[model samples]
Target: MPHLTCTEACGPDELQRLLRPRSDVVVEEPDHSTPEDAPPDAPAPEAAFRAVDGPFHHYRRTVHVLERHDEECLVRQRISYRLSVPVWGWFITPLANRELRRPRHDGTQPFWAPAERLDPRAGQVLGVLCLLSVVAGYLGTLLSQTITFAFDEFDAGLATQGNTLAAVRVGVLIALALVVLADRRGRR
Candidate 1:
């Protein structure tokens, strides 16, 4: 089972109230059997919240309210998910599901900051340029090879085409770098 665990501070009553209204969450009866490792002062969980929707729909999550101190409650959440597919199931599903579970900070922001901040339009243009560069390079290589094979000799003109392809690749790279730099500067 793959799981994600995190702790949050909120009173048991408040947490229960919050979970009750959420459409995806189902509150469960608190488990009476406390772990021996748990502190004696720690309160039993008031209720367990099971998240029922999203990418990890097959998973079960039990939210536990561990303790209360100075009006703040410590909550522990345990999520368990199963990968039913064969072969690469365990490896790929967990990674894909985890990515889906991750909160997207980009939200309604004009720019997405996955690694470097980039406007959506700029990113799309950059992606197109990159794809074009790859296709052009591949076509250039195929043409050069075909020409070489047909004459049983390498042609100097083919070298020019290769150079042109390389130049285009470099130009695309430079353009992408400039866009990133400009976006970073604009942020300031």
Candidate 2:
């Protein structure tokens, strides 16, 4: 693919537009660990971020060389996805899972979750699930806080936004009920 040239300096805003030009794609928790004490022979600055868009959710590591070759910078992106198997990827890729689950930088791993590994204790699973639900609810609230713009786009009146959210709640209920039923009934 051809590289993009920005007229102004390449800042975070410019990188946001250049790297991901999609409205639906949201890159979260970007880590730009550029070492200041590194020597001149050190490698270019690398950036790692979690991109969650549509059906594709993965972590990407991009190396953007600051050097100019013909006044153009070269960017190389590498993606490491934990799930790569055909039907059930989580069960297939044991080595990749191990690498992902391994402890990294100060007991903190970026965008990594121990999803497949579950404690057999029912109470423990319930506690974890409850915490997850709380986190998910907080995120949902954050999304709803900014949803006024979307509501206005649909010619939202006083009740429009409320009604829309109520509809979403109902949809979520139905969807979750279906999910519970699907596991019991078996869906292809």
**Best model number under lDDT:** 1
lDDT of 2 by residue, 47-82 (tens): 555543212223343445354454454444433443
Per-structure clash totals for the candidates = 0, 0
- In terms of TM-score, how similar is model 1 to the real structure? 0.34
Residue-wise C-alpha lDDT for candidate 1, range 1-188, written one tens digit per residue = 56677677877566665334232222122344554555899655554443333323344545576776867778776655553333334444555445424323333212222333333344355556666778888986786567546544544576765676688678779988998999899899
Model 1 alpha-carbon drift over 4 Å, by segment: 11-14, 21-52, 83-188
Q: Which ten residues in a row have the lowest lDDT in candidate 1?
A: 21-30
Query: Pairs clashing in candidate 2?
Result: none
lDDT of each: 0.52, 0.47
